[model samples]
Target chain A: MTQKYYAQIYVTLRPSVLDPAGVAVRSGVQQMGYDNVEQVRIGKYIEVTLNANSEDEAKTQLDRICDLLLANPVIETYRFDLTTVSSEVQTS
Target chain B: MTQKYYAQIYVTLRPSVLDPAGVAVRSGVQQMGYDNVEQVRIGKYIEVTLNANSEDEAKTQLDRICDLLLANPVIETYRFDLTTVSSEVQTS
Candidate 1:
């Protein structure tokens, strides 16, 4: 039987990597008077919906997808959460 | 006493809004030969480290930061997870 899955994937730069975007955001927040804000690192949050035969099958597919398309392994790292969803929801 | 807090924020476009980036990603995934992928939506994931007296204070500050700098209320929505971190960790 086919099962539906929804995944929330987080892709982040390795800590050793310099993040110019994060630096810009930190300055912006400091300008807003939120001086307590110390640091900000920005990354990608991707939501994916898909179908598979089993949880393992879904996970394997997702990992491959992340490696191939969603993340660049050189300077970034990625993690994801998968949950089952009702198949009734249309795939749009 | 001051405490250290780490926040993981997710900022995504509202469902009704058009997501050209998502569209592009979905097509790319499909081209990668992942036919089972139904939909793909991309958004921002941010990691923030700050100092607050309490969890409530941290949440309040984070909400304001997200509203004013991280997310656009008109077409985007955001949510976050906040966790306490050891004060010994230096904020770099």
Candidate 2:
């Protein structure tokens, strides 16, 4: 049987980049009387599950997928956490 | 002095809803030759920084903001981790 893998990827804009959405949200928070808002940046969170022979193979595929398609190279950066998709947890 | 707080929020779709973006990514992955792709879901990650009198006050504001603006009641749900925006770490 093939192994199951799940990954959560987080993609965000570079700090130097101008994030219009973040600015808008910041202003909105102020208007809402939260007056304490300092900064806000929005990003993407992607969850994916896949089948592979092993974690190493799954990782290679994940790297390609993120590099080739999931991210915008111009202003955004990304990171991911991979885990086995298992319901049972083993405790020592 | 006011305390600075930073929050990382994760918003995701409910399992019952249809996610076209997720479907599209899964297809793209499979087509790219990583035929093991099983499922995909797309969501939002938000980073916010603010000044508050205390952690309790920050939590109250965070809850309100997420309820009113950050997530959709009809289809999405969200969670956040709040931390003080301090660079110094105290280790025992």
Candidate 3:
């Protein structure tokens, strides 16, 4: 039987990578008088729902998708959390 | 006293909002033979480091920022997690 899984993936720039967006945000914060703001990094958050035979398959699929398309391996790193959707929602 | 804090903000289209990017991702998943994939919502993940007097202050500042500039109140909803930076990291 297949189960529905939900994954939340966060893709962020490596510490060494130049984050122009982050810099702009930092500047904005400083301009707004939030003088203590620093090292602001902007990233992408993707939420995917899919079906698979098991947790391992769900994770494998998501990992493949992230590595191939969702994240840039040279400058960005990604992490994700996969959760099994309970049937209670299906009944509701 | 001010302490350094980090926030991870996830901005996503509301359930009622139309998500064209999500539609394209869904189509891509279907083409890739992931027939079970659904609701591929795309969003922005922002990481910010700043100084705040307390955890409550941190949340308030972030919430205000999200409402004012980070997220589009018309179509997107946002949530965030705030964590304090340890002094051990400051020393290291």
Candidate 4:
């Protein structure tokens, strides 16, 4: 039986990698007087909706997607969560 | 009794808003032959590390930060999760 699945993927720079964009945003935030903020790191959040035969299939596909397209393994790491969506949404 | 906390924030465009970037990525993915992919959406993932007296204080600061710096209220919505971090890391 095929089911719809929703995946939320997060891709972040590894701690060793420098993030100039995040630094600029942190500076802006600090200038606004939120000085208690020690560090800020910015990354990518992606949402993917797809159909698969099983949770295992979805997870496998997601892993392949992330590795091939979503993240650069050298400087960034990625993680994702998958949830079952209403399979009947498009049928009727 | 200030403690260290880590906050992960996600900022995403509202469903009604159009996402050309996401569309482009989806097209790329489909070209890569992942035809089962139905849709793709992209957003920002931010990590903030801060010090606060209590969880309530941390939550308050996070909300204010999101409202003022991390997210644009016009087209995007933001959500965050906070976790306690070891305070001793900085001192040691």
Best by DockQ: 1
Question: Over the stretch A63-90, how does candidate 1's per-residue lDDT look in tens digits?
Answer: 9989998899999999999999986666
Model 2 stretches with alpha carbons more than 4 Å out = A87-92, B87-92
**Which candidate, 1 or 2, has the higher TM-score?**
1
Every candidate's lDDT? 0.94, 0.89, 0.87, 0.92
**How well does model 2 score by local distance difference test?**
0.89
- Using Cα atoms, each model's DockQ against the true complex is 0.87, 0.77, 0.78, 0.83
Output DockQ, candidate 3. Answer: 0.78
**DockQ value for model 1:** 0.87
TM-score of chain A of each: 0.93, 0.87, 0.95, 0.92
Model 4 C-alpha lDDT per residue in residues B34-90, reported as the tens digit of each score = 788899999999999988899999999899889988888999999999999975665
Candidate 4 B-chain TM-score: 0.93
Q: Identify the runs in model 1 with alpha carbons over 4 angstroms from their true place.
A: A88-92, B88-92
Instruction: Name the candidate, 2 or 4, with the larger lDDT value.
Output: 4
- Per-residue CA lDDT of model 4 for A1-92, tens digit only, reads 88889999999999999999999988988898878889999999999998889999999988888898889999999999999998566666
- TM-score order, best first, reads 3, 1, 4, 2
lDDT score for residue A26 of model 3: 78
Q: Which ten residues in a row have the lowest lDDT in candidate 3 chain A?
A: A30-39
Preferred candidate (DockQ higher): 1 or 3: 1
Candidate 1's TM-score on the B chain: 0.92
Which residue pairs show collisions in model 4? none
